[model samples]
Target: MDKIIRIGTRSSKLALWQANTVAEQLGHFGHKTEIVKIDSIGDIVLDKPLYELGITGVFTKNLDIALLNGEIDIAVHSFKDVPTKLPEGIVQAAVLKRGDFNDVLVIKEDENFFTKDAAIIATGSLRRKAQWLYRYPHHTITGLRGNVITRLQKLEDNDWDGAIFAAAGLKRLKLLPEKEKHIKLDWMIPAPAQGAVMIAALEKDEDILEACKEINHEETATCVGIERDFLRVLEGGCTAPIGALAMIFDEEIKFKGTLFSPDGKNKMEFYKEVPVNNATDLGEYGANYILERGGKKLMREVHDIEKSTLVYSTKSLSHDQTNNLSSKIGVTSSDFITIRNNRLKRVIVKKPIKNALFTSQNAVEALLNNFSRVELDFENIYCVGRRTKRLIEKKIGKVTHIENNSEKLADYLVKNLDTKEVTFFCGDKRMDDLPTTLLNNYFIVNEVECYQTQLTPRLIEDKYKGILFYSPSGVESYLKENTANEIVAFCIGETTAKKAKDHFKNVVVSKLSTVESVIKSVNDYFQE
Candidate 1:
């Protein structure tokens, strides 16, 4: 009896179809297969943009986790969602035959919207958004996220003129609408591996590798490999408006790639055809062609729309996350800091702790991931910032003490705390102000480093009226690559404001220490 090969995939219809196709392909080679459904962060998170989340291969992360843990023998994935670089222990098993590699715009009605001066288009992709804006500068671009079925339904449901989607996904799922309803964006370059399905498996699985090799399409693999190699050089742990497509002719492979600013006003493009014999290093060669020119500078300068009242945030935020901001003003953000829970630190938290101190929302979230709200409902819950307090109140219990900054929180704790000792949960990069003050006051403080924060500063290519900042570290990160001397700084609190005042011309601290307060400060400052 043959051992059943387990295929892992997202529970979505497209993913299921891909998995079944792989299973059937494997079965053809005298191998039995089983489909294993796995949940991915990309599928669960519909609110945040993929790039802003600071996660590489958001769609493949969970699947990779599952694969690493031996939950499945193989994982079928949309190749484009997989990062250019594979995880260390995982290797690509096969690339299926290519499909129609073009983006389609599912329109609401007639083509009249295209001829109009201002139209509304929706897409979740940064590449699609930039290309569309380049072609139609006057058009408004809204975010649309979900599976193929959900997106098609959204196109019909929303008042927008159209929404962009992959033609291959629609065709694969049989979700493509009538010919009159959708238009193929022939001019736009598709993402690397856009229409390809890839099978990934553990590096040491010899039997799985041999089984998958039977289904691999050499031509498809070659084309996508070059395209992915191009992407690997250009995108280094960051997302950008980048697009590439590679085609194999009889004797030669032709490739075209373009990089654009976030708003698509500035672009760098390159096209090259290399003989099939010498095409192994074509991707790296072509990418260098763009980088040596203006591509490097252009990547750094992708700016916000200048004419509009745009505010750039150092942290990634969805429009819904900030209900306080008006629709008239455009808000674009990319996270400058990445935070993750520390697994080792989580273990240090024991039950029935009398008192707790949280400096940031990340710390609270990290601690809660290990200990539930009921278990963490201490006699006294002390935290800094209103948002942190709000989260505690909603999830855990009441906040006995809250302040805008660690300095203030420490001050409050010094005078009011009847308990001689407290456990403080914080990130690795947390400021030492509070800890220093506590120890100096002779208070016994047990600190648990629950999370870690890393700065990932990016260039702000376009001019904005103001920039919103949530942390002093964010300000430091932004200054590493770019400057905002002429613009106003909208800071979440006084500590962040202090950092901004050193760089920005006008620094406005929020009346209260919260994301909403910072937005309100922006509106109020403009109103005044």
Candidate 2:
């Protein structure tokens, strides 16, 4: 091309490296190139996680603006960071050949973090965080944000066990530490388009777009296109913990996609192999298959979890708890926060049961898992929360009664449910008042150990204005790694407030025990 192809990119070191790479590729085509470094909002704000910023395309928005303003002919981006929808008048020009797509665990030499229970792991990606927790629920995940070198420096400066990084980034920058210091996390699925580099040019700039296409890798584009299509169909964008990959194998395309609950305790996955000729709609087909197989409900629950900001619940909230808050308050595209540092200890129950009582979804899941092992003739089922009721109803067809609290459930059972025998599925760490009330009321309660709540506290690297707590156990978990130095405590109810008051002077209690009320309390306190 006769005109100089100005490439716009973020000023970060890694971003400049990516821009230079594209410039080098275009140079081979006898095209003149100019590198323009720009600073994005994502790079400017380092205090909060990217999702909390309430903006999509945090890293590429500035470049998009630059390209539209005619300051640059083309914008280069890490394909994964670019929003699925491009800005007006801008279109994808080319996708360079992809690099290594695995996420690597970088640690100090001879580090014992992985072997230790509840070791601190640092990452800024929700996808990485969710997958890591799903595999190693015993470890705690802390937020790590910065440029490639800055994040590595932070890992060296802090006492954190280890941090995660993209294998492609390290290879591009040639900054991979010793083999002993980094371990390839092959088991974890990578984000869609993770290792690919993308270039965008205005639709009217045919000269630059045509020149860019000369270097486009058709195979790389096809693979990432399918993966991104799957992501778009699922509405994951950049917010949800969704992963998809499409690879051409022996004239066929093999695809794998995964979706996880916000807490990472539950997961759904789908895999398929199809001819490459029919690969255009493979992503969409895979998305629908997973959604039909309980992935739809999991996604809704994840959406609810993402709508809140820094909720520390003792137990994972049910779909109803999260959905109620999402409905009452607006869930922004960029505002989703959940910090679940505890894991549920799975258990087995072999007892015969006629009626089942459940206070949490964890309890209900335990019973559902053991239903096939034992001949359960459950005539009636009583649950304390809407999420538990829905779970049981999906499995057994119906729930006899559902209430907001255990006390209400006990009262309803005493007046309405007349089954002589009952089986209560409960956690090891549970409130004694509900079981005590039932045992004293002449109800033959056969307590079955369902699950145990294990605390895995994370290291708090950044300071927030306030912390939201839903249970006394949540308060206890937060205190394990941090103190209420200047931060306010927003509690779900009086019981949680009492626990927060022991350490924090500025403790505010919500009027009701709901996620919406807790968020309201936070807003009111901050607005003051």
* Model 1 agreement with the true structure over 1-528: per-residue lDDT tens digits: 278999999998889989999999888889999999988433342234434432256688788777777888999998988877677678999999999999999889889987788899999898899899998899999998887788778888889999999999999888888999899999999998899999999899989998999999999999999888888767622368888898989889999988888897887888998887678977766676676555666674433233347778887553244446764466666778888887753346445667888988898888777777655647788988778899989888888888878888888889988777888888887654888899999989888888888889778766578889998888888899987768888998877887788888889998888778888888788766
- Location of the lowest summed lDDT over 10 successive residues in candidate 1: 41-50
Model 1 global lDDT (CA atoms, 0 to 1): 0.82
lDDT of the candidates, in the order given = 0.82, 0.74
Error of 1 at 20 (Å): 0.5
In candidate 2, what are the lDDT values of residues 240-343, reduced to their tens digit? 78888888889899989999876678888888999887788888767766754557666633543333333333333322343444342422111112222233
Position 71, candidate 1: lDDT: 82
Deviating ranges (above 4 Å) for candidate 1: 40-56, 236-238, 300-528
- Among all windows of ten consecutive residues in candidate 2, which has the lowest summed lDDT? 331-340
Candidate 2 deviation (Cα RMSD): 17.1
Which pairs, if any, clash in model 1?
301-461, 303-462
